[model samples]
Target chain A: MSEPVVATDMRKLAATQLFALIGFTVREARNKWTLLALFTLTTLFLFALATLVSIDVVEGSIASARLFGTIPLEIGNTTIPVSDAVTVIQVAIVSLLTTFGLVLALFVTGNIVPLTLQTGWVDLLASQPLGRTVLIIGRALGAVAVVAVTFAYLFGGSWSVLTWKTGFGNAGFLVAGMIILFTFLCCYSGMVLVGVLTRNSPISIIAGVGTWFMGLILYPLHTYAEWTTAFDPGWKRSLASGIAETLYWVLPKSLELTENATRATKGDALAWTPFLASMPFAIVCIALACWWFSRQDY
Target chain B: MNVIETRDLAKTFGGALGSKVEALRGVDLQVGAGEAFGLLGPNGAGKTTLVKILLGLVGASDGDATLLGHRAGTPISRLEVGYMPERRHYPGFLTAGQVLDLFGKLLGMDATLRRQRIDLVLEEVEMSSWRNQKVGGFSKGMQQRLALAQALLPDPRVLFLDEPTEGIDPLGRVSIRGILRRNLEQGKTLFVNSHMLGEVELLCDRVAILVKGKIRREGPLSSLRAPNPEYRLTIAGSDEDAARAALAAAGQEAESVPAPPGLTVWRLEVGDRSELNNVLDATRSAGLEIEEVQRVRASLEEVFVQTINEADDDKAGAGGPGGVQTSAKGATEVSVATREVDNV
Candidate 1:
């Protein structure tokens, strides 16, 4: 009983430290007017989509139309089918979730590591009894936790609204939010590295966004160059293809992860390569950041 | 037992290309349990660096240090240690209460105890009124008060405070000093690094003066002030000749300087207290009226300046850059011409 009590105490201690960091991240995000604005915008967009989905559908002999009061959603005088309309709405929601969700989360949380490394806070924190690894990991996890809640609110609200309005809700669509969060985690790990190394918020954001864009473009470039016959098979083609592939594999697979999420929602078998590959990449980035943070003087 | 100990703790930063800055070189120090120890140095004299090493905030390049019998930089070593950095900034969004809660959580205090202690510490620092206010809106003095409150949250056995009163108003500084004095009275060892010499002189039981990363002088305040036997005598009248004659008869060297109107001050170098007594007796017998007699000792600031000047002169004479080579045993030997200070 005594041993169990001690173990319980240790667990509580760990939880306390980790949660304190999470609380700090939450408070910081709340204080940023930009983050609050983005949250409000996302909430409003979800409600707007819900309103549009609530529009009545008119079915005639040759055409079906989605009527927003008196206005009909039509393409070239051909009324859109309800299924197709729902599909279009889902696609739009997914695109928004993947694009704006990722970008806003990145922009909002980019300064977490840099702010933690600020002189007074860092020195005071480092003097605490907590392990350096715990501090770094807790901070990174805090940022991820913030992004997770934001993603869940935006994506989940949109999904719930679509399901209620159209009665065609797919629970699998929720996985896309998780995937976006994972992608953000991967990208944010790099931001953490830059922030810890430089302790500069702007530099960290630039590095994180740069890595994300590189990940998005390199994989497609590699696939295109590999399959295309535009250039003859030679050293130049091989070099370009090789560089692109190496960079794709080395950097996070942001595009591939989102694509997999889209595929998963469409009742297709999801390829786990991008998801599995991204986990290690993110882990390595966090490990490197923690290693650097632990070794450096505050 | 020593609550904090460091031997030959050295830290060197940025030696990659052409220049290296040695922040600490052979700092050997010990703070006994419940003792309030002061660390005094000029700007860039490595006082903060030493505190950082002890608190495990910075790694030492050489030698070893321990707090509470654990090696420095280990998590357990800081378990019983509290540190208030010179410049403290909390997350702006957090209320003062939240800041204390965060620190208490980091210190692994349970919720009930944390709540109770937070109130106690807040009241101690006189920040109870601002407990609900955001730290961002707080003044520097208020932030300092909050910092002190957090440092006291753990009820630590050893507290390391860097410039605890810096940027504070006079009343705030007095309040902080009183809090530190109470901590010392409660048998908590305090390692204070400050540029405020008067506070150190008033509060510390022992002090170590660092000059150019070396411990130039260290001992009890009384010992550091008067390492040699000396005394000062004030004569009632302008009887310099009689005082000199009295001191000469007593086999002592005395320097005469101007005092207030119709008075002369005589600074006598004596071998011991017996010699000082003999000088006083001789002055009385010589019919030279003695107005006042007091021990001559250097103030902490004067000692600090003299130590730094002497270190600079030594550096100039050796023609070496202002670096001293140190051994792991905390023995520092000034090596001249053989090693370039720039490369260190």
Candidate 2:
């Protein structure tokens, strides 16, 4: 008597749902005014940077930098090679973006998981012809996309200004955007897990920021703890080694990832230990969140 | 075939300190295709929980259910299912048109198809005039209409509506009822969970009454409330004393029931047809004219209240249900309404 409801193709439905989730979240972010805030702040920062700083290049090898036609740049030399100067600017830009962007972006986007699984919304969402895995993945990626836009705008804008003023392009600087993205995903995965578990936005932010803070603290602690493993007394070495290894393996390597972002400036090889460990941390966090979410009782 | 069916389905929610609240006891139910089935219950009666389980929003603790003959909660089952949740919550940022566009895409509609269906559903929900209006600015009733529109977007085979008219005004309620009736005529299965007995009576062909997670009464609407033994009589005039004296002589008494102009209606119960004849004979001898006679029956609201009161009495005698913590605020006393459900 009733139509089979068009009998949606299973695979096609998943893809459609995924895209719809992204579009839906973007609309939500727009309404929340978070996206506008990101755009505004990024624009002001780029505007100030463009107006205040000027780079003078000679034969693409050496350059003099000045701020607002008044103060001269300081470094190991009055004139540095344009290539080296680009690298320095790249490191500075990546570090600044990751540190400040992490706070603002995660604070704003921390509502993603809980909002996706919101009471009335989830009732309709989970009932759709899509897998639970797809639902959570779509929501996570949707939040990432919102951040991605801001990252591209702010980071790309800074990169453009550096190249335009110095008249030397550093394509490697763009790759550093990849590192920042992974760092965000790692922290966001923790927030997703917390959101799925508790549906608390503030706690979600804390989970993400706390894990990032832990990564910042643990990277150095583990490095030294490894040193103590070779030099400290046997019992102390064993205790320190055990705690450091567990934590280093369990948490995301945000500081180490930042180092890799800096490495991207010089086009250096990434440190595999932190990079590899961080990947699994994000995957595991999100997988656990999805597993729990699928079994959740609304 | 049964479009919606539950076989010994049950759900128990875990509370703090190892306590459990049995939201649904062992329950079996079946609704056929093209059926307008109403799920009736008081607050905290597991009505909402049942809908949630079928949609996979909440996982069932035990047993299983199906939608349109597929395992309930599966993506395949949901493909042909549309649900209107009790709480009408949508992203306030989205316009009504945008909301439909998103939902249409989720249903795998292409850009052109999405556009068409969005327009069609907007018209259906009486939201065409406000398609571009942001949901944040709309009243609750407008939001309710938007929610209903989304559920109808995919032309689903079965619709699960929970309190479909909760925030609507009187005229809007009538319009919604008409839409639901039209859906039924198109042979769509409707599973409605609502407290509005008037609406349920108007829209449902069959119904199940749930109390404390159990289906106490379920059957065709006509069978659920059969013809009563009481009869209403329209007397020629408003002569209460004479009618009472005559009926009292026949060992019966009458209660006044409101009537239109021309005759006064009096209601009285009779044990058999013979007693009815006697009352008529006594009235005639007392010079009172009997203009008309009609059987009296109960309203759905009356039936619902009586069922709830009976369940309460039964629960009191049975010492209440298990796994109920006293501290749980505003929870139902009985965790399980019945282990065995009989439609009869």
Candidate 1 residue B310 C-alpha distance from true site, Å: 2.2
lDDT of 1 by residue, A56-114 (tens): 44562224334544566554666655555565666667777677678778888899889
- Model 2 misplaced stretches (Cα beyond 4 Å): A1-7, A48-51, A63-77, A226-241, B233-292, B315-344
Over the true interface, candidate 2 deviates by an RMSD, in Å, of 1.7
Error of 2 at A206 (Å): 0.6
Tens-place lDDT digits, model 1, residues B184-253: 8888898988766777877898999887778888999878876675667888887678778888898877
Error of 1 at B51 (Å): 0.8
DockQ of each: 0.45, 0.62
> Where does model 1 sit among the CAPRI classes?
acceptable
The fnat scores of all predictions, in order, read 0.64, 0.78
Chain A TM-score for predicted structure 2: 0.88
For model 1, what is the C-alpha lDDT against the true structure?
A: 0.78
* Candidate 2 reference-contact recovery: 0.78
